[model samples]
Target: MKKEKTVTMGVDERYSQWKSMVGVLYDWLANHNLVWPSLSCRWGPLLEQATYKNRHRLYLSEQTDGSVPNTLVVANVEVVKPRVAAAEHISQFNEEARSPFVKKYKTIIHPGEVNRIRELPQNSKIVATHTDIPEVYIWDLETQPNRQALLGAATSRPDLVLTGHDDIAEYALAMCPTEPFVLSGGKDKYVVLWSVQDHISSLAAEAGSNVKMGSKNSQKATESPSVGPRGIFQGHTDTVEDVQFCTSSALEFCSVGDDSCLIFWDARVGSLPAAKVDKVHDGDIHCVDWNPHDINFILTGSADNTVKMFDRRKLSSEGVGSPVYKFEGHEAAILSVQWCPDKSSVFGSSAEDGYLNIWDHEKVGETSGSGGPKGANAPPGLLFRHAGHRDKVVDFHWNPSEPWTIVSVSDDCDSTNGGGTLQVWRMIDLIYRPENEVLAELDSYRTQILGTTP
Candidate 1:
């Protein structure tokens, strides 16, 4: 009991220190307290853009207690433009108070606790969700009617369902970038693929109509259309933890599993893996992402407390695969890793260590910024660390429309008296912009302030 108290106090102290540095470290930050923990978070399409700020649709899940039904939330968020938020205002957020920038726009009482959420790249309003079941539920946010998440409320119906997995697919889910295709991995040691092309035209038409067609009372909801898998690839010997589709091809994708294996598949060929890498990590691989900007690079995060970068061209089907680089920074198992949409060489990783680290592979051998021995001991490619969350960051997503903006969630129930934490933040431009450009801007500011140019 005493040790637990000490640990809690340490976390509190660290949070206090982070709060003190918010103005210096972040250009904008919004802290919203959640009534229940969210296992996943994602950014939807940009809605309205103005001179100072833009409104966007944000998707989140509420894993509620039995007193109320679990819900998939659609929120409207006002994102402040770059260089617009004042330092004082950005630093004044209360950890316990909700931010004014976020407002709940609609709610779909989910059939189960939403474990993960992914939006289709081709149609942002179309989203896929994973629950504690083998089937994947699809929702068209625009056409779905809003419902209150009341106690004993009937769960909202899904627009479509993808069925193939023999066991529960609790977390691993992805949507194809090039087509209306869906990928999922599960405990059955199989990766399933389904194409929603046949349904897209109808969904698009309904979304464009701007009218709700479904029954509001979920109890009387009609049966949703179900689709079977186009392919079921078998390769992994254990539970498949995550799957990702290649950026340029709907037929190409990858899967990582608890067997410590990474398998690549091309649907045009066969149901078997085109290439397999055994023992990709010493422990179970939890997350995987293919770089959209540079298709050659792929990232995998695992229980071994490290992230590995693999070059796809070097992989082979006959033997163990080798990684190009191993990033050893997190103190605990990494839960998520995503390549930055804006930069090919840059990516972000979140872990059980309560940190979200941004890394740049291009800066691996660069001299430490501090030019000190202690700084030299730091990890090679780590560029920045976000330590605002007081517990494990379960999920985070980079906003593709807003440069460098991110939305991260933490399951802070044990530390924060039972509620979770949601933080949306963006680091200052000087931290990420080119050094020469920043220097020129600083010189211009100096000329205005002191009436002298440097």
Candidate 2:
């Protein structure tokens, strides 16, 4: 299938975003009374909706000084005071000021999945978050006519929901692009196929709505999406760390786990794996991603401290047991690998090494005997590194719609240190600027707190 491409951002557009995000972070930290031991943060919807704007922010903050606290606070930076974050992150606030009933969607530490879904006549946004508990909460993040409602909707009961998996917690979830299905993998060694339409309808019924949102034949425009576990996949003997749908097929998906194997699955053929590769890596496979362009090309990062590429088309070809391409670069176990959603040529990896590196699949040259990459494996596809976090980079995402904008979340390293785990970053090259917006927002809020301080 021929793919349609769009114009990538020029240096000017990237520069402008770099200025906006950096200034926002500096201002946020320099002035606010952020809660200590901060857990998670993310970009929020704009308080004032523009006709069709392209940027967003708001967050949870750690204190400016080195002190760490145990409580969590959801601040909505858009409304001047701290606004609430999504449900799980905002459970403890007072009822009067409570944003939405997001409490029901509580989740623990896991990669946050924000996706741009186009189920209707136009595109919208939804964030799928996993918790330590069994469920994954799918909150409708943005609705077309009203963008300010994003925060409110995120806190309300999720638009779609799934619960079984019981005791085993889910670690990864990937939504299929062309269907109403989502794949979930977890510690239980089970992969579930959930129907978004069923989940949404469940919510609608609970609210006592007799309204028939759309015709039974229509796939979109429903009051609540279905949450049915339409299918179940089982094969791995250990914890399933990650699962991703094949870019080329709607029914086919791949799952990797602690069992040291990678299994390619196809729903059409039932629960059995279409292709199975045992001992795929030396250790537990932590993450897996299908190349945006080459559906047969799969990328896997592992506790073995190596990143390996597998080609299903060549599974029965030469080096049947070995990877098509294995690149070793990280000193620590690689936790995440993301093939840029916008540019098929580039991909990024993050790990315990506290660095995020970008690579080009086509330009990568020869590797050492141990399957590790040497210097300058490729060029201009923008092979580079960002050493911006002090702690391990848990997860990172290349904004689906914007190739240049990147966001990463990690564990905290303490406030005095100038780095972040819960942070936003860009691949664009821009000079760092000074901070003064705190004067307009947080500083004013704080000054009001310590009025006329000596």
The candidate maximizing TM-score is 1
Best by lDDT: 1
Tens-place lDDT digits, model 2, residues 1-454: 1221121223234334433343322211111212222333433433343343233333332322323221112233222112212222222232123222111122211122221111210222444555555666555443212212222233233455566564555466777766666788788888877766675465467656643333232224343343557788889898888888877676989999999888888899898777788899999998999886878788899999888888787775322556877876676899888887766766888887766677666556524111012234423232655555545666675644433556565544432234333444443222111135534454667757778653
What lDDT does the true structure give each of the candidates?
A: 0.88, 0.54
Overall local distance difference test of candidate 1: 0.88
Q: Candidate 1, residue 299: CA error in Å?
A: 0.3
Q: After best superposition, candidate 1 residue 298: deviation in angstroms?
A: 0.3
Distance from true location, Cα of 414 in model 1, Å:
2.7
**lDDT per residue (tens digit) for residues 1-454 in model 1:** 9999999998888788788888988888999998898889999999999999999999999988778898999999999999899989999988888899999999999999999999999888989999999999999888788998999888888988889999999988999999999999999999999988645444546456432323243224367867789999999999999999999999999999999998999999999999999999999999999999988899999999999999998876584678999998898999999998888898999998888888888878887632111355668887778889999999999999999999999988777767788899998888677789988898779978788766
Return the lDDT, model 1, position 283: 100
